[model samples]
Target: MQTIGLPGTAAPHARKPGLWGWLLLAPMVLWLLLFVVVPTGILAVYSFCQRDDLGRVVFSFTWDNYVRVFDPIYLNILGRSVAYAGLTTIICVAVGYPVGWYIARRPAGLRNLLLLLVMIPFWTSFLIRTYAWIAILKNEGLLNGLLLSAGAITAPLELLYTPVAVVIGLVYAYLPFMILPVYGSAEKVDNALVEAAHDLGAGPVRAFSEVIIPLTLPGIAAGVLLVFVPAIGMFAITDLMGGARVPMIGNVIQNQFFKARNWPFGAALGVVFTLMFVFTYLAVQWHGRRSQR
Candidate 1:
């Protein structure tokens, strides 16, 4: 029997979107230009200019602020911030990956509930949550009391006002971001591909390394950028938990703005910080595309 092609069987040709699409996107373009683009332009202009003692901008262009930014003290702080963010990203990936995988494999009805639980903390103010950490980590706080009762320590352990607490706060705050993207990728993974690898005599470790890891890499890259970048710029947790003892880059930029009354220096730091983020984003994208290929 001869058969005719149906409309449903015809291949659709892709066409360039018309001007209507650009018209629809105009509002978003204008918003971005007005808010993000304009502010960044102003900041870039300020970065090259000198500031007066009263913190007013002077139009005279100078590179003194940029030179000061490379001084050892600020460089050391920037290095420390990178280290902290690196550690946070590592921890978040290690912890979030398994949880995301498990959640993604769960029944559809349960996955939403689990995700909601993860997001519930965001309903409260982040500052309030950070403050609560103070009460929990203090000398006479719940941790110390529990340790004392358990005879783990003869005296109250100094848990608060330390680098550990700062790390804890950062990981706690950003973990959900790492998980959500990984879960999204994991959910889309094909079960048959894993089964095929196993059937081909691949062991668990080999199967993961050869098949699963490659597929979920997009999520891992997204999660790493999500957790690492913001962690580097976080100052509040460092201040509240680390007692402002060891300053991060974020603290220095903040000091320049408010305490040091050096707007030019702050603007320079802001520009540099933003550039770092852009580099990180590009690096992540490059890695993701390479892994996919």
Candidate 2:
């Protein structure tokens, strides 16, 4: 006798998403299309178009804007931006990893308190915070006054309106981005695996290098991307802290739009800047996958 197959018992083919699923995703899809996709498309179109004397984007297309992007002056600015961003990423990784690790190893109550401290800066406006740094770093400011009073220096130090100040601002602003992701990764790390390494006669350094580093690589990658990307495009800090004397890529792009009245050139620079980020991220992901083998 042939056995009858039970109804709704056998595995069904994957069903097509119903109206409810689409409705749930509708808001996110609309948001991306409106804000991200549409803006990006506009930028791309503007990059190829010409700007009139008034900096209005003209309908006519031209390669002059893109050509200017490769000019020596802009190229130098781009290089400087990369150097600043790279240094910031390195410093963030060095400082944030330890802070994240320490926080993760703490008891839940203390861990939460430490995390809250990290987030406290976010409660205030970032612009206000940057301005506060200006007060502290300027000549004859609090830092210089303290040093002068203590006889640490014969004269007030000129710390504000310099490259050093720009780096400081970048590091301060992005450090939390690095810490949060690292903490998420570190908190999930298995203590048993670390203990096993110790039991197998591995030293702390060896275990950290061979096991912990590998485990937390994802967080490190994320933090680097977060810090590096924004740092490359940072304009306000460079302008406010670095005195707007030294030109960064962001400064150049901003000048093209507002100062020089060259909207097409600005758009071209922006397009190239965005593409660089996309390529860098893809390269990182490829390297990560290759290393996992």
Candidate 3:
């Protein structure tokens, strides 16, 4: 006997993108091809190429660019960058998760207001915001001024242009990224789940550990991806706040491209950064899938 396909089911599942669907997707596909795909391809090609005396990218292939990327100095910078980013991610998660959870659990009106305050930073240019932090953290800035007035210290604490300052800037900038995604995720979790766990004799900590956290893992993963990767390559924060004392891979890549005029090496570094990005995404995805099972 022949089986009949249901109207609202098998047909829609089997349907392929028709002309309109392709048409609708044309702009996005074009954007990805032109911007993301093309630039990545160019970077990959240049990574295997060489630069001439004039710093022009030469088409001839060699592995020297990649070899140089593995140099001890560059390796050290890469490791430091990862460490700084990791610390920043950890700090943001610790701070942001609680704030996000609190905000998500708040009443609708207050939640909107809190979320608005959290997002207020984005209203201004990020560069401007970074410079604002520069003002706040400088030796004679508001923080030290307050501390001095409060008799907290004898002199300025030298907060700016230090690793501590860099971490502060990173956390300040990326904390919102963590909070927003987490808020989105936590908002979806049912309050009923918590009560249900309590009814099942689970304490607050146990309920949070076994029930709420699992539900919110997606947001945490998203927050990690958003915070960690960009933190690693935050050149402006390091340059402005770190005083070049902490040269991250981002700064190195920037110098290679613009200051040192080493396009091939820069492109090689870009390729490595891209691979790091891909690996990070893959790792997060794998963990997310494994957790689901």
lDDT of 1 by residue, 1-293 (tens): 01244546344633454799779999999999999999999999999998886888899989998998899989899999999999999999999999999999999889999989989999999999999999899999988999999999999988799989988999998999899999989998889989999999999999999988888888898899999999999999999999999899999999988998888889999999999999999988887777666
Go through the candidates in order and give the C-alpha RMSD of each one to the true structure.
4.8, 5.9, 4.2
Off-target runs (Cα >4 Å) in candidate 1 are 1-14
Report the error of model 3 at residue 118, Å.
1.0
Comparison by TM-score, 1 against 3, better one:
3
Ranked by TM-score, the better of candidates 2 and 3 is 3
Comparing 2 and 3 by lDDT, which wins?
Answer: 3
lDDT of 2 by residue, 1-293 (tens): 01344546345534566899889999999999999999989889999999776778898979998998999988988999999999999999999999998999999999999999999999999999999999999997999999999999999887899899999999999999999999998998889989999999999999999989888888888898899999999999999999998888988888887889888888899999999999999988987677666
Cα TM-score per model: 0.93, 0.93, 0.95
Give me the displacement of residue 147 in model 1, in angstroms: 1.7
Best by lDDT: 3
lDDT of prediction 3: 0.93
- What overall lDDT goes with each candidate model? 0.91, 0.91, 0.93
